[model samples]
Target: MTTAPTPVPSSAAADRDSTRVGGGAGGSRTAPKNPLADRTAPRRRLRPAGGPWLATLPLLVFFAIAFGLPAIAIAIGAFTLSPDAPSGAGSFTTSNMTASVQGAYSTALLGSIKLSALTALIGVLVGLPLAQAVVTSRFRMMREAVLSASGVLANFGGVPLAFAFVATLGNAGELTKQFKLTSHGWSLYTFNGLTIVYLYFLIPLMILTITPALEGLRVQWREAASNNGATNWQYWRHVALPILLPSLLGGYVMLFGSAFAAYATAAAMVGASIPLIPLHIADALSGNVLVGQGNVALALSLDMIVVAAIVMAVYLPLQRRSARWLS
Candidate 1:
């Protein structure tokens, strides 16, 4: 039987048959590539044309003039006699440095440390809860009011602040007279009074500082803790406190520095009666206690710089650590 010449498939039909066999049960046509499944190349950051130094030129210049020159002058002055020194006076000596830590100077330094530590510790204790409460409150108006008031109060220090406290709580003042507070041994010029004064501004400063960190605590963290059956106290102990420790410590350091460097309020309120580094430095510089002690004043300034440097060393790391999670 002459079967019709086996119909020879066309080239196109042969190709289609091959594709069907290769593609299996899905289909003969190739599938489209999914954009979501494709790995994307990472974006490169664009750098400034002039570089970082150029961008920071203004700040560098300002710092050099404002801080660098003064620091250099202080360093040189600390080790050298003042221009007002006598004809036979040597150019350089270690007596100023030696004298800064002696007797009353040492006592002043110790007093400053005690005051700063007290204020900072108290500020952290009081401000932490206030900050937490403000951050967690649903009332926008309350937050705004509190923050605005804090901003104002934090800046309200120096002579005016001393006057305010003096009027309200000073010996023979209105509160003292009305309530006989002085009879209870309350004195606005004492160390305890200064501690209270420092807290006035320091607490507000701590509030302003820690509010941001409190806000940075993720709601998801709390939710997760709750899902895992953690109580509020447990959540704070395990999660919140650990994360906030850096910020808390940083705030304490800031408060410490603020109280440490304070001059105007203490000068106004307590004068030479209270032994404080800033007041001592002022006394030495102004020659209120002795003439030609300018170099000693510079030495005291150097001592302060060293203490501030140590504080900054501790603070910078904590600040960076806090930023890592908060940012």
Candidate 2:
């Protein structure tokens, strides 16, 4: 009977009674917060609602000014009536383009295409071996020198390179005089001569662009192939060529574009003797006659747009394919 003398509830029990809260059976109703919800709530509060668009503003402005404005101006100029034939005002016409396609312009365009193709082909053929040599050579100093020279030569464009070629191989060039060669005998102003000069620039660009692709072939992969009894040619043909094709094609397109858009070199070397598109466009802009010349410029601009489009059409897919393999 004295076992507990009636167990008295403690103050804690009294406090629980006052609050009416407990985990035991028959406790009063109370909602518990979800653990996941509590964790995610802070993250939602901390997140920014709008900020990424501000980062893209600069790029949009750049494209609008650099590309968009120029394109619109050229397009407008192309359609505007020439001062010489200003009867029709602000109307579109294809007569200027049609006329160009008939005479020396057509011939020059064809020559340009043929020359560019040949230049790209020769550049690749020559550059691939040189690039391979530079990359695989054990002579570090020589390789560095060659690579540096190639970088410098690649950017040696416009008037300076043209003048150098003239001074070295022109009718009265230093090299020609040193060798007693005749100007008419070794004219660097002809189509073939221009192609060779273009190749000078094209080869360096090819080397610069392709060396990286060749270098990207991991040494371990080559070693693995060799350990499996693969020959060097077999290793390159089976493993290397497939991966390199995309980059090579992309480089070819760039070389083609460079050769196509070349104006200063061709102008300096051939001048009015050659009817390259860029020369024609420049003449149209600078010539005394103004009216129909604007249309001709427009047509040339259109041609440039076409060339650019074609290049992109070819380049973008190759780039994507290359990226896929790289990834």
Candidate 3:
């Protein structure tokens, strides 16, 4: 006597049917997409900021006005027959570049390179040991003092530096007067003297460059080597120097650049008498002797830039390697 069960329209039954329709075979219902939802609301991600670029804009503009324009002028003038003329096909020629290798400019370029190479070698030899000592020293105060002095001395170049050396070692200088070095056959205006003077800044610059490399040598590496029965000399030769070699080479390149491009100290001390490229460049700019040799100076500058590019190509990789060990 069972009548057919009356179907009850309950909330739970409706929900069950909805879940079965929307969900997968597991009967787990996920949230349904709402067409009316405001996805354009504040909950959406914000746009990236331009604030950092704004801070750098002034520096970029300054570089454009100063270094960028001068560099562009150098390039244009290097290719042109006349720096005074507008750069175009009509003004274009390779004579300036060709002339650079042909005349006194050739002598100057070679002399500058020779001077730079000599100074860089001396700088590295003297600075490397000093840096090592500072890094390994027990006294913190002494290290800091040496580092501070190195920083100051490295920047202390140009006319004042030349004058300081002159005051100490020039023919009429205090030391010269006191010791009578001139009578004993010492001269301050010669190549050897100039190199000696260059060492004042070069050694300090190298110290500043190489100190961090010395500091970066890991104590654990030394301990491991010692445990493996490596002697001090063997450890340095095989373990430490190999790691530091790149940094040393990079620092040497920098020292070479510093000496090569130096102007004021050479200008004030040796003047136009010295056959150095910087002096040649200066003479060209001033037109003291040559009436219109600005083009030649531009060519010389281009040559310098090319050499710099080559140095950087070598230095950058070494510098990266040094930085990795330090980091």
For each candidate in turn, the TM-score is: 0.83, 0.79, 0.80
**lDDT of candidate 2 over 13-60, digit per residue (tens):** 877567654557775744454999999999999877765776788998
Worst 10 residues of 3 by lDDT: 40-49
TM-score: which is higher, 1 or 2? 1
lDDT of 3 by residue, 1-327 (tens): 989998987998787666554566776664565654567554444644686897899999999999889989899888887645444533878888998877799999999999999999999999999999999999999999999999999999999999998999998999999999999999989888899999999999999999888888899999999999999999999988988989999888999999999999998997866789999998887898676778889999988888888988988887788677778
Q: What number of backbone clashes does candidate 1 have, counting pairs of residues 3 or more apart or in separate chains? A: 0
TM-score, predicted candidate 1 vs. hidden true structure: 0.83
For model 3, name the residue pairs that clash. Answer: none
The C-alpha lDDT values of all candidates are 0.90, 0.81, 0.88
What is residue 82's positional error in candidate 1, in angstroms? 3.3
Give the per-residue lDDT digits (tens) of candidate 1, residues 1-327: 777778899999886666553464775674455665453422223455678789899999999999999999999889987666775464888878989999899999999999999999999999999999999999999999999999999999999999998999998689889999988888989899998998999999999999989999999999999999999999999999988999999898899999999999999999888899999999898899989998999999999899989988987887788788888
Evaluated at residue 315, the lDDT of candidate 3 is 80
- The residue pairs that clash in candidate 2, if any, are 82-291, 82-292, 83-291, 171-183
